[model samples]
Target: MAKQFPEISPALQEFILRQRVFFTASAATTGRVNVSPRGTDMLRVLGPNAVVYLDLTGSGNETAAHLRATGRLTVMFCAFEGAPMILRLYGAGRVLRRGGPDYARLLATEYGGTEPLGARQMVLLDIDLVQTSCGFGVPLFDHAGERPTLARWAEAKEKQEGLEAYRRQKNTRSIDGLPTGLFEEDPVPVG
Candidate 1:
């Protein structure tokens, strides 16, 4: 059986907290849809109706572009090790770049003293609905180590000229030619 809720329930929150990876999906009014697998300790649950995830610099900025164009976002998590449940959060999101007021406020209020890890953007999702389904077929997998390559790259860049150069080189636009904030005259870091 499937269940739906107006907001995240306590049990759902507990399940979300245990997930090591989640998938984000978004699309514009037309054209291609984008689905991304995200990890690396960058997600947080702000409340029953709000969630935030750090968006790192990548080759394509599809999520940001899609959100900017349509504001629709979906985050999905499946239990791969423990319980047999699948959860999805349906909502709209806004991109908060680093140095922006929203970014500063989220950092201060939600993240506290954590340093930005060269993230190019933060997607603040205002969840409107929560849905759960029985993940009876989701296979269980053993835990493996987190990949350090991304953090290492970010750290090295931070030690060098900083994230701005990297963002300029890699985060300029989505593959579909959608505009991303990377090429802005005054780009803000978002991680």
Candidate 2:
């Protein structure tokens, strides 16, 4: 049976911390829903009702664009090598860019004052619902190691031109013509 709670409990937090990967979903008011797989030790549980994850530079800025249009977001984690279970966090989230105060504060607090190579922005999820379900059908899989290609690419690009230049070319707009708020001089305010 699936169970839902108001917020994450201590036990639930433990499970969340151990997950090797998670998926984030978001959608604009009318466009397609974007679901992206995210991994790396890039997430942190801030409180019983809040969590944050470091979002690296990606091909599409769908999540940030979607959140700018609609605050709805869902983060899901499934056990591939553990007790059979699935966890979902439903929340409203905001994107904080690298230059923002909230981003700096959170980074310092949770991440020990250093940023990742392709650090883009941090997505904060103010979770309102935590759900757990039996994952009896979720196939088991073994863990591999993290991929270094992204970091290598980001490093090479930064060394060649600059991070801002790449962001301007690739990260400025979502596929749906929505602004990503990346590299913006005066970014659009979050609604």
Candidate 3:
């Protein structure tokens, strides 16, 4: 059976805290939808209705662009080790870049430290609905611990020159040519 809750409860938050990975899905008015697997200690639950996750620099910035275009976002989490549950959060999302107004605030409030080296922005979701279902079909697997490859890669990038040069080259647009707002309000060059 499935259940819908008005807001995330403490128990639900605990479950989220236990999760090592989650998926973020979003799309714009036109173009392919983006579903990204996110991990590491970047996600944080802020109060009952809002959740914020630090977005690291990646090959593409589809999520930021999608949110900028549509504001629709869905987050999904499945219990793979302990319980048999799948949780979905439906919400409106916003992208706050590294130097944006709320960016530092969230880093101080939710993260309690300086912005990480590879952190490009913060994706904040104002959750509207929470749904949970029995994940009977989800396979169970033991937790193997977090992978350090991404951090190592990002550190290497930072050491090279920083994200600006890389963002200019790779993250400026989605595969479908949708603008990702990577340069804030800079002009989108024709590639």
Measured by lDDT, the strongest candidate is 2
Q: Over the stretch 11-115, how does candidate 2's per-residue lDDT look in tens digits?
A: 999998888899999998887889999993999999999999999987778999888888899999999987999999999998998968999999999999999
What CA root-mean-square deviation does each model show from the true structure? Answer: 3.5, 1.3, 3.1
User: Candidate 1: misplaced stretches above 4 Å?
Assistant: 159-162, 183-191
Candidate 3, overall lDDT?
0.87
What TM-score would each prediction reach against the true structure?
0.90, 0.95, 0.93
Q: Which numbered prediction scores highest in TM-score against the true structure?
A: 2
Q: Count the backbone clashes (under 3 Å) in each candidate.
A: 1, 0, 0
Over the stretch 1-191, how does candidate 1's per-residue lDDT look in tens digits?
89999999888899999989999999988779999999827899989999998788776789988887888999999999977999999999889877777888877777785656866778989999999999999999887879888888888888998877777766776778777764447354353
Clashing pairs for model 3 are none
How does model 1 score by TM-score?
0.90
How far residue 89's Cα lies from its native spot in candidate 2, in Å, is: 0.3
**Worst 10-residue stretch by lDDT in candidate 1?**
182-191
Residue pairs whose backbone atoms clash in candidate 2 = none
